[model samples]
Target: MLFNSYSFLFAFLPLLLVSWRLAQGYGPTGLALVLLAFSTVFYGLWGLPFLIMLAVILGMNYAFALALAAPEPEQAQPAATTEAGSEGEAEAQAKTESACMCGSRKQGGCRFRLSRKSLLGVALVLNLLPLLWFKYSAFLAQNLAALLHVQWHFTSPGLPLGISFYTFIQIAWLVSVYRGQVTPQGFTRHALFSACFPYVISGPIVRYEQMGQQFDALSPITAENLAKGFTLFTIGMVKKVLLADSIALYADSVFNAAEKAFPLSGGEAWLGSLCYTFQLYFDFSGYTDMAVGLALMLGLKLPENFDSPYKSTGIVDFWRRWHITLSSWLRDFLYIPLGGNRQGRFMQYRNLFLTMLIGGAWHGAGWTFIVWGALHGSMLSINHFFRACIKGKTLERILALAPLRLCSILFTFFCINLCWVVFRALTIEGAGRMYKAMFAGPFTREAAGLSATTDGLAGFAAMVARWLPNNYIQGWIPFALLLVSFFVVWALPNSHEVLHGRRDGSHPRLGWRPTAAWATGLAVMAFLTLILVSRKATFLYFQF
Candidate 1:
């Protein structure tokens, strides 16, 4: 269910809040069971069959891990009896069991060792099979039709909701388990950690180890967490309802018109593209904010997804600022695994390329998605090379000149905007036409697609008929909202810094400030939610 929906916001959330608080008095295990059931119900809203399918997959993954950790017959042999047995074997065995009693107990140690590679292979296969079946089935089917020289079609497979996130979560969980980072915990807790609803649909991708203790225990609902969560949820709601959806109006018109019109003139082409760029940023980031806030309401801390990406001065900085969770996920799970920076310069470049290509493919099953990923990947690599060549000299030179820094920021934004064309376009041809119109078209008179007065000339009348007013305020209120939103984002301290306050034990009062913030946040959010309720809108990334 959508967080923005009335049913979710009013009915479901209230019920959940009451249930969660009541369950909290029981204990962690009880709370986890409650959460697990709640998560399943949330997911089950899609359909009963899909929920069953998801359950089977989750069960398979959990069982696979158990199988990997289970002792084998060959592993039951005493280590001392083996010819290769030595101090290393004894120490390894001790660490595998209980370190405290290994030597003192005077018991023969088992020689079996769990293979990380084996476990990872199983996890990757399990995750990849369903992803391929659902996401790429149509692509493959079309290819097969052409190759066979016959008519053929395939029905689309049932894609479980949040499969994209759950797949990645399981992959990460398996890696942590293989690395021995996972603490001893019951299977119910592990299941809850992986399938928790707030993060499941669109994730900040929580790590298994970070949540291990939270699954075992939780703190009571405090004024501080409530205040912070309410503030975040309110801000996010405003971003989604007021800012993102408004831009989407113009974006939808322009892109829809582009599919039929070969090339668009200035106002429709450029402004439309710009609308999409802004729309996507607010929509995705807004959803993440709400998700984080909701998790906090439940006394769980989810990761932050975005920083101010537009404020970034370079492409490298842009990645660091945008979709932080996904970026870090790619870095930790994919980039580091491909030998990281340790294998020398050439391998580093190779890893960058491969990671980006895969990352692009991850966005969708379409060529447009692939191109979008490639565009960003190439930008990142170029930025790396540019940094190496300039060293500190580039920034130092810019610092000496204010206009230079300004130019750099503008250039970075323009480049990022250019990349968004690939992301927004429905087809590769559509992207090419948009770019052609943007760069090669005439800049004046009728050709520019701006309105021309009759006094100007006779030749201008026909083309000028197509021109639309450029008043920013009349068409897109959300554009104005974005201006306010950006001001707010810049006004606040970084989320990580704000989060640090909660952990550092700095705010000792537990008084009115927290309560006031929550109240204000809730009021603003409720007001905005009411305003946007009439328009049915889907989350931007839901298409992917």
Candidate 2:
């Protein structure tokens, strides 16, 4: 059920859209049910066993949510877009120490004798069990065994697709339920939030409250929504199919070679790593555009995930701009819960470090991810410390200077790219190999043609082998694309900007409209993307 797959493009999505439109006439419930049913089918197609796992996980969470639910305490409104801004109340008093969701809200007929805090603790443990068993058990056991000097080996199961995202999203929902900030909407709403197909596989990783309302008062399907949806979807498809996948040829070639301990010329290493940097951004953010566009077609809005992250001037800024959903989730769930910045500067740095370490581990069962996380956590702590040391007008003036700002952006990009090398590598050793090559590998033909030596496989890399006619041409394409990626990322308005964009955050860029010209352009782009659908490449984040 990949958004880029032929069956999904021609059959499933179109059929779902028609069905969804017809169902909308019946009311929101009809729309929700149709979506939920199709979403169920979508996940099932990935693997029925995982679908069962998802269903069980969803059932348990819904039950826990209901158990945790008490009458919604009076509040202004469930936090909206500003959820990102205020997620970390690390200032304190946020975590309900004694009162759990169900403990005090409905004292009558309380099923559990446990207090709210205890119930939440238990529920949280239960909620994380599947994720732990599915994703981390082997890694944790292997480490524990090594630490204890034992010959113990642990076998782990295949990670269910979207479990990381599902776990995080539900944790947010469950926590919100426990916080008594939101009432349990219903079973269908619960399913819809957790299982809606758009964000189901690869997500911007939305929260419960963020989407609850979108499914409730879903506006009737309209032509304007359709136009915007198609336009955005087409743009995103171009990014993924035309750019990201194409760029992956270089990324995969370089990294795969490094993993096998092959000698990488400095140019090969950087070409691959930088290509990957752009590839990942375009892949995930491109997926975000398609996800948001799809939801919009159904009159739902997904939170924005990226905003020109490569343009970030600092590590903290990079985190804020990149993977915005996961960053907020970490702030709310991990950092704040660890006392955030409440205790003191020392504790704040400690919390930030620990939050990133966990965030990194969430990506995969490899030391590469932990190191990646640790590097980021350390950088973040340093970033915060520097901010703490710098003060008012001096800092402002330094920031205002164009030259210094450019240096800052470049410095930040360099650090991020280095970290991404660790993140993308298959192992810590492989990462070291990449770093060695990036820093000081031979630049000669003896390196055996960067990508050619890697094992036989057909992918974008294979496509590249055919598309690139000569060795010289092969080397130049990535550099050229990198230049274009840099320009697109730093100069042009992003998809959001193109729609409701301000290029400099103050001036409007050209935007889409419900006109024939826009419609025709989108149609042509869609047709081109459809031609690439036969490749059936999965989005990179789908593995996470």
By TM-score, the best candidate is 2
Candidate 2: what lDDT? 0.81
Which residue pairs in candidate 2 have backbone atoms (N, alpha carbon, C) closer than 3 angstroms, thus clashing? 100-116, 497-501
Clashing pairs in 1: none
- The alpha-carbon lDDT assigned to residue 103 of candidate 1 equals 29
lDDT by residue for model 2 over 1-544, one digit each (tens)? 7888888888998998889778877888888899999999989998989999888888888887776774422222344456553563221113331233334434222233455566678888988888888888888898899999999856678989999998888888888988888788777788888999999887879987788877778757888788788788888998999889988988898889889976556667777888999999899988999999988888888898888888888999999999999999999899998999999999999999999999999988789999999999999999998888885758867876999989999999999999999999988888999887665424322332445455544444543443332321265677788898888888888888887666466634457776788778888888888888788789899878
Q: Which stretches of candidate 1 lie over 4 Å from their true place?
A: 70-116, 144-150, 392-403, 444-522
Cα lDDT computed for each candidate against the true fold = 0.71, 0.81
Q: Write the per-residue lDDT of candidate 1 for residues 1-544, one digit (tens) a residue.
A: 7878887878888887778788877877667777888888888897898788777877888766665554332333345755566665655555555322122433465344344466569677977899889878887787788889988867878666677777888888777766667643567766788878888877877888767777666655666687677667766777788778877887777676666664466556677777787788878888888888887876888876787777677888888888887788899999998987788767877788788878888877777778878877788878887777677785657644868766777788889888888788888777776776566544455465455454455545544544443432244564565566556444554444444443455642322254556577568767867778667587877655
Using alpha carbons, what is the TM-score of model 1? 0.83
Runs in model 2 with CA error above 4 Å?
71-112, 144-154, 441-475, 503-507
- How far residue 83's Cα lies from its native spot in candidate 1, in Å, is 18
User: lDDT score, residue 156, model 2?
Assistant: 78
Model 1: per-residue Cα lDDT at residue 81: 54
